[model samples]
Target: MDESLLSIMEVREDLMVSPIGDSEPALRSAYFLKPIAKSLDGPVSKVLSSSMTMSLPPVFEPKDWPLVIHFDWRRHTKKKWVEWVDALQLRYKSVWKKVGIFEAIMSIKCSIAKDQNLCFGIAEKWCAETNTLLFPWGEATITLEDVMVLGGYPVVGDPVFAPLQSHEMREAEKKLILAREQLWRRTKAKASLSAWMDAFVNSGSEVEHEAFLATWLSMIGFSSKGLVSTLVFPIAVHLARGNPIALGPAVLASIYKDLTLLKNSIVGMTKQLVLGDKLELEVTLQSPFYLVQIWVWERFKNLQPQPRLINHEDPMMFRWHKVKALKIDNVRLALESAMEHFCWRPYVQYAGKFKVFYPENETLVLIDTDLDKEPTGLLVSFATCLRVSLLVGIQSTIKKYLPHRVAMQFGMDQDVPSCLPRFDGTKDFAWKNYCRPISDRSLYFPARLFEGDITTRYAKWWKRSLMGHQDFAKNMGHQDFAKNIVRRKRSPRSPQVSKANKNGNVDDDSNARKRNSDVDAPSGFLLKRLKTVSSGNSAQDGTIANESIDAYVPTCKNLSNPSSSASTAEYENVKRISPLTKLLAKDTVEPLMGRLEEDFEDANGSKESRLSSERVSLSGTQGESYTF
Candidate 1:
């Protein structure tokens, strides 16, 4: 505990913030990322480089793949080799940029393979062929049964929930619960109307009460089109004359029908990516704050982003695949295979990233209503509540695990760690910075958390016993760490002079830039590895079977002669992935077997990645640098 916190008074639970507790009204909740900034003179930039290009395997038609031949690696000429390499590299860059690089290159390769393989394409056919199995995507009203079955339970194999759950809604919402008001009760029903009419009610600013009026004074009629005051004016006039007998019930009933139906119309998109078919869901699970922030995807398109870095209109879809069917070690490999063939769009119109996360709170709550599909197309409940505990728990956890001194930075705040500079001063130059705003440059931490698209260790190890399946990926791994990058410092001298005197080649001219000759390589490539790609052919089982191995000897001039520079990994250093792996050509590791017998081959021959302190030169407008 912090020394300053010992002087505190009594602490109490916040009733308004609890989703599972009795609060005034049901609330809506979703996760979002908040932009933070850091100072950047020391570890200003992170680099991912490759000395050579690795070719992206071609995406074949899934149906066509089963008929194609898996040729040996000896048929192509030198020219063909170059063409293939260029094509593959281009594919890697374009695809990562297009869909967003959240996983290893190996997994991406696997996805591309699956998209082309016919066997994995069954979901689309199933969704289209059988009406009974499809999530009711085109509906206006959901049966109460559907909501109970899919959403009522917090845990299930293929669970989905939509609209408001019966028990979660406010009791006054009985107008909408025509099927059975007996299922749930409204709290203080009699006092609710009295308080609603009187101006003395302590509503505490609930979102549901935002639309409710406290008084009926505007009887002459308001000009607003969507206001209930105008629509219910006739009921007001009758009540005003002391004849408030029963019109409110009918009016509320009509509103109820619309509210229930309206909630179901705005749906959350869910799709199955072959990681595992079963989609387990949770409603308002209280979790680590960073977990939510890291899961959200941010974009730079907002010309004027809100100060808090939140977007209420933006929809986020988190797609986590469960592959308990495979060996525990093959998770990365299985994911690589899935991405090799094609990309999966879990939420097409949304700014969401797809990857995986193991569940932390994965228990089942059985509303146990046994209907398969809701008539209103709602397969799951709408998220209407957010539980942000502004208590010491969140504060301490973030402080300890993702210490504020080293947490993700967005360049908006002062006193933050150094913000990462542009690769070439272009805001969108790096994949992480793509589509990010020019002014919103920030350095995020633990690639798994801040990337907004990569999966975390929790998903990899959550509920392992329950999964009862082996890892799906046997042959996948991360690209070799980039090494030998040339990170430089800001010097008064020009690039020409700086290279000559302090840091230079044995054969350098005096005009070359002089660097501090006493600096060691900034840091070795050290990041949570969730990426995979090799400059090789597609393996038989729809995953990359071999890690791309690149061998390159750096010229003496680029080598650093360190005297006393602190290692980047120990301090504030970011890793630079050299486009190379240290694996040999002769080694071959087979992956977990697929349900169907498939062809397999060893893909090889790659590029080298050099890691060094990355030297970043501001390429665009050099505005005043902003910090935490």
Candidate 2:
């Protein structure tokens, strides 16, 4: 409610969280509660055990994971889309900026390597009750920060479903409809994706450009397969007219929705397995899940494959292009012991160097409507990272984002997050009110990368918040690790605390100057900028329509062969292992088995379990290519 209590949503020491989905309303909860200390250690926290270990549920097992049906159309069709995007970027890079999709479009240029094993492993840890991953170390989730930087979606913009108003926008929609109708007439079927591309790829009209964006959103952004859908026409029209839509939050919501689905399906399979029933259900992921794996790679350093290259000039996603993930014998065990290996603030390390997103004075503002200021710039992008708001996913799917829950991601202290109110999926809830200012100015806080600790009561409350009762703590296999924390009077990593002077400004000028110097520094090697090509016509706007698709092919480096030495070394020095290690060791599924035989010692005699290593291919039906 006030400036000093900006990042916390405090609660009473005796307060308790309600059961995850109780029918009763949450009692007397407020967005702003009693503030907690932001220090790394608080009030001599006690630990009951010397070592911590976790008990992974049945869902963590690869043997229990449901078969995934991914959209893989890229392998079947000629990649004309690549040529179209390259040509489009050259002519309309400015237009892309106006529409808030410059970064999103640029990101698709590179192909990210797929690792479904890693994706399935992380999805298993998702806690739908709190929208955070419950790991042995603490709670962490893919935040809006990850979405903005990795996925290149705009954080602040008009709602995705904002109604079209201008006559030009309506005319553009009519043009798209007519074009699709013509294609349908000739094909004697629904609009063919290939036929649609031929009709609009280089038509030179602005409407055709809008059609290109619509197809891009359907195929690349939102994952629609085969026949084209008309759902994205309105959104495309808005973009063509230079209006920025909030695709960042929308894409994030869709990712969250798909993760929840995957998590729920895994739980369902676990239940089926427990009851001795044959599992036949398959899970279909329709969102851009490569972003999910990239999120994992960015934070979990131990699990990341060595990157092929680092180019600061390109979108952040380019770093992982064609890089293969390390093959871990036990994903669950590796994740459990990865607390110290996790980079709590990865973006902070590259913030000064990344051309895509660097902090600035203007970026500190919550929201600014100045048209001259680029929407995708660090200004709006940075502000979007710190605010708590609702995300609008693809058509009808909606999710709430509570950044305050993992305030450490934004360089702030952890506290009890405001209770996210449950919403009915069947109704359109508060659709008209989404355009309101997303942040409260009174609760502004500066971003810092140094990790902060949970409030004294927050640490105690988190243990019980899982199932909404004290009994849930007894069920966890891991012990309390509060004693690992130590109080420090001053840390070089932490920003100096400053007082608000009489003029309502920070008194610490040294920290401000240091931040400015960092912002001015170059990151790594910059890529060579592409030279402009002129189309020689005002209508074409210098788009390279005649350029050959083969002239600019992007090639991927070969994946490194899986090696046991590196994978084994990470866990070789471990002193303790969880009980699940034995169960995983006995799994005879060759593909699921990692090279951990050298490290794991199963004292009990090994028992054989029949688990299938053959993954079902959905490409025959789905017909879409996978993109990271």
Candidate 3:
């Protein structure tokens, strides 16, 4: 079939996908591309069926779309349209271009294309090339690697983020949630690492423990080789005020401290990974200066292929458990530490637990140790600093947001460590991870989101897994909606009266229950009478019978009258007798209920009348105290 027959709806149906698990290795398959719009008069029909329309998105220029875009009522030929698409394909080679903002603008393009008929061509190309499917209502099941490959990028292992602004940096702290839990156990709620590090070998969190030992060992590897680096920085408590994160307690290790404890912790963790748990661990000695290893004790098979450019000439593959700087364009040096460095920075070397913005390979290169440059007020502009599974996924994102040739040159060349940290990160991981050409299918990174999509996914998974756990509902933060969900954490609200009475509390509840007992009293008789009045269709009518009041007494005399109770009971019973005839005919139930409330004094005068009746009824006589 020709492109003319492929309508937007047909394109959607073609791209419909079935979910494959993350553990499943990806493979390419043939897609049946056929024409869809059978009822169309033309390819760019203004109206297709009743809902879908022929119009281009705002991102597309008028000269690019074949349809008569109503923006200016300008139309173009199919020949011109093809040329425009060609220009776009050439200009923006990758779709990873600026994927996230406050509202993920990159993903929104897919949504717009799915909704509009004219954008079927672009949608088709994305789905086919990326090996992704576009579902109905603007959702596409895509992994970070798929977007990376579609945009002609590489997949780098161990993703981290550099947040420049305070908000974005704060958002980046989500990665610490799991680590915090480990740190808490290590610190024993004291937030004192001095105590914690003494028993580091006993720390239970396998992930953080492995990551900690691996990071320190990597540093040790570099330090032993006589190379000094300024990459690692400890994210301090005071630095993150207001929302102080639980990054455990700060362990400001010094050069003067005994190195024996540090050595024991690393050896213990490594032995645990290899011998104790019978786990096989792999580490690549990129150089004496760099060591590529797990941030924790991770399952080797569950991880994506850990390819490395061991020779940068003939690549090699390694494995592990997986989990920045600033610079200007000119002279290369480490960016000034954004957070404080309370730990020993002995000739720019670090030890113990610290946080970094990105994860680089173990073979780190430190050159021009004396060079320095000024930062040009360019801040890292990202709504979120996500720890992506594949950092390289952002590679082919069409927008190469570097400053210029000077910045790109300093950052791109792997040998130069003098440029800004963030600029270098954008290029280094992609360049280093080029182990081999992946042609079969797009390689995926287990890019877990600490802040966005992945978090929601984990929450949903928990909701399912802990289905019957009684307190799960209360912990989910949807307390108001708990009634609608599968199970509620709280018990029903019926046994309160008995519990209250047992406590010897003669509070307002007892009084209210006694006064309201009259409504419950007559309901036994009223419902039986209601059966005779109704046609048996009003299932909801029974609810009002429970609330049926005795009478609407407006004056004090009516309340004092002996026949008032009988009269009020008769009045309300009579109303129920014509429930269907009177209530349904005029549709005046709400108004009648309002009238009943307005003329009522039960709620308003009952307390006062009760207090008066309970007060001493003197009857023109004093108490039996008799003037003693």
TM-score, one value per model: 0.17, 0.65, 0.15
Write model 2 residue lDDT over 214-243, tens digit each, in one string.
Answer: 877776545465567777888888887788
Please identify model 3 stretches exceeding 4 Å from their true place.
1-234, 238-240, 243-628
Model 1 accuracy (lDDT, Cα): 0.18
Per model, how many backbone clashes are there? 101, 7, 16
Pick the TM-score winner: 2
What's the alpha carbon RMSD for model 2? 19.2
Writing each residue's lDDT as its tens digit, candidate 3 over 459-500 gives 233233234333322222112211223232211111111111
Best candidate (score: lDDT): 2
Instruction: Tell me the spans in candidate 2 whose CA falls farther than 4 Å from its real position.
Output: 1-66, 71-78, 185-192, 203-206, 221-223, 353-377, 424-435, 438-449, 465-479, 485-628
The C-alpha RMSD in Å for every predicted model, in order, reads 28.6, 19.2, 33.6
Off by over 4 Å in 1: 2-408, 411-476, 485-628
Error of 1 at 314 (Å): 10
Clashing pairs in 2: 72-624, 72-625, 73-623, 73-624, 73-625, 74-625, 329-594
Q: Model 1, clash count? A: 101
